[model samples]
Target: MSQISKVVLKDVDGNVLHPQTDAGIVSVNDAAGSPSNVQSEIQALREKQSEMANIDFFVNKGDVNSDADLPAQDYKNGWAYY
Candidate 1:
């Protein structure tokens, strides 16, 4: 079996995040945390966050057949169309 090189990662404050070993006894692999893996993770998170940012809970409930910009109707019953 091939041995993977392991190291402890630290934050900006020098606090240890990941260690060379998982439980101080069992071996832990950090190969999945390569730069390319990190970049892809960041990209996936950004895309998911972007989709989350577009969640207009109010405007999303409007009917597709209406001009959703009526000015003075109380929309408590349903969507007001212009």
Candidate 2:
């Protein structure tokens, strides 16, 4: 098993934002003028963490059937010379 590391971040107010987990803590901060962006980033990170925790099965290219053909007329065949 791989060892997990802990990460911590504190704002000027001295609040502990992240805590250590079984794997470790990953901390990120917002830029000077973008608190909303930071919140969005944190939300995305939580989603990814949830996905990792609940992952059951994974499929690789080898598992796909190769007999499938590309759809016809999906795009133009020629490009402009310009």
Candidate 3:
């Protein structure tokens, strides 16, 4: 396993806010916070991931210059016209 040598806390002006300190008993594999809190966040994102991925939206080619600029509607018609 890899080890973190140092962690620097810096400010907006690139000034050292706190002195370097050893990371005591830190686990890289452990959850950031409480298990329940992490699980809830993961579940919420998983539920929305599929719904967001399957969203249907229109594809704007450009402004219609003339009658020929518009696409033919006789083919398979949907939000995406390409």
Candidate 4:
């Protein structure tokens, strides 16, 4: 009988997606050159959650005929639906 052994993960471009490890440990590469272990990744996500909690989501609700009907107002970081 054959037994399963080591495994290696890769991206479509053939880049190693996971950090080298000898055990069951895992890591996260949130972005290019931003390699972090599972623990640090969790911490970073928690911090981001806290920061996001303070953000206010504004929705510019109104009725419009089409995209051109939208007023010439700054809709940055906000949503507008018609």
Query: Could you estimate the TM-score for every candidate?
Result: 0.28, 0.26, 0.32, 0.38
Model 1 C-alpha lDDT per residue in residues 17-60, reported as the tens digit of each score: 76553223333343465334333444456678999899654443
Backbone clash tally (model 2): 0
For candidate 1, the TM-score is: 0.28
The model with the greater lDDT, 1 or 3, is 3
Separate clash counts for every candidate? 0, 0, 0, 0
Q: CA lDDT, every prediction? A: 0.50, 0.48, 0.52, 0.63
Error of 4 at 19 (Å): 20
For model 4, what is the alpha-carbon lDDT of residue 48? 89
RMSD values for the candidates in order, in angstroms, are 11.1, 12.5, 10.3, 10.0
In candidate 3, which residue ranges exceed 4 Å CA deviation? 1-36, 59-67, 70-81
**Measured by TM-score, how close is model 4 to the native structure?**
0.38
Clashing pairs in 4: none
Could you tell me which 10 consecutive residues in candidate 4 have the lowest summed lDDT? Answer: 1-10
Winning candidate number (lDDT): 4
Q: Candidate 3: what lDDT?
A: 0.52
lDDT of 4 by residue, 9-70 (tens): 78899998875643224656764658665555556667889999997676757778754477
Itemize residue pairs with steric clashes in candidate 3. none
Any idea how many clashes model 3 has? Answer: 0
